[model samples]
Target: MTEQTNRPVPNPCVGVCALDENDLCIACQRSGIEIAEWGVYSDEEKREVWRKIHLREQGVLKE
Candidate 1:
């Protein structure tokens, strides 16, 4: 038998677009500032948030 590994998923845009001083998603609790600054952020940074936000939504990670 062979073992299997799980694949990564994409982000969930809940339409809860609201930014506090930190610019984090008010509903999903994602880093709003990070999202906004994505235009300037490197691919690695964007990837980091994508991974974190997904984990957060699935209750696998905490804010």
Candidate 2:
């Protein structure tokens, strides 16, 4: 039996799936490329992306 030490992070996708003029997703606030590459990103990378998303949501940043 294998022990799982890693838990997958919850996806930020909200089914909006639309990109703005800057190529950033209007709903999830992820860049189109980031959304495309999300499946392959490591947990640390994902966390970084999440941090950016949260910042955007909080109006602390923008793409």
Candidate 3:
């Protein structure tokens, strides 16, 4: 199998059982929509999520 070029989506679960008012993860900060559609998302779509989480990890984003 060929390797993927883009960064992979992160498993950003923090084990917290709460979804904020906007439905974004309290820990990972991904939107509820993002979470719900994750399974069906293409690898390209997952790359977007990876970008978001990466920014959050770098302290460049909150949600």
Each prediction's Cα RMSD? 6.1, 3.9, 3.4
Total backbone clashes of model 2? 0
> How would you order the candidates by lDDT, starting with the best?
2, 3, 1
The local lDDT score (0 to 100) that residue 51 gets in candidate 2 is 91
Top lDDT prediction, candidate number: 2
lDDT of 3 by residue, 1-63 (tens): 346655565555677747788677778677788777888888778778878877866879764
Candidate 1 lDDT, 1-63, residue by residue in tens: 222213333344577788656556767567766656767755556567777877876878764
Give the Å shift of residue 37 in candidate 3. 0.4
lDDT of 2: 0.85
Error of 2 at 7 (Å): 2.8
Candidate 2: TM-score? Answer: 0.81
TM-score-best of 1 and 2? 2
Best of the two (1, 2) by lDDT: 2
Q: How many residue pairs clash in each candidate?
A: 3, 0, 0
Which residue pairs of candidate 3 clash? Answer: none
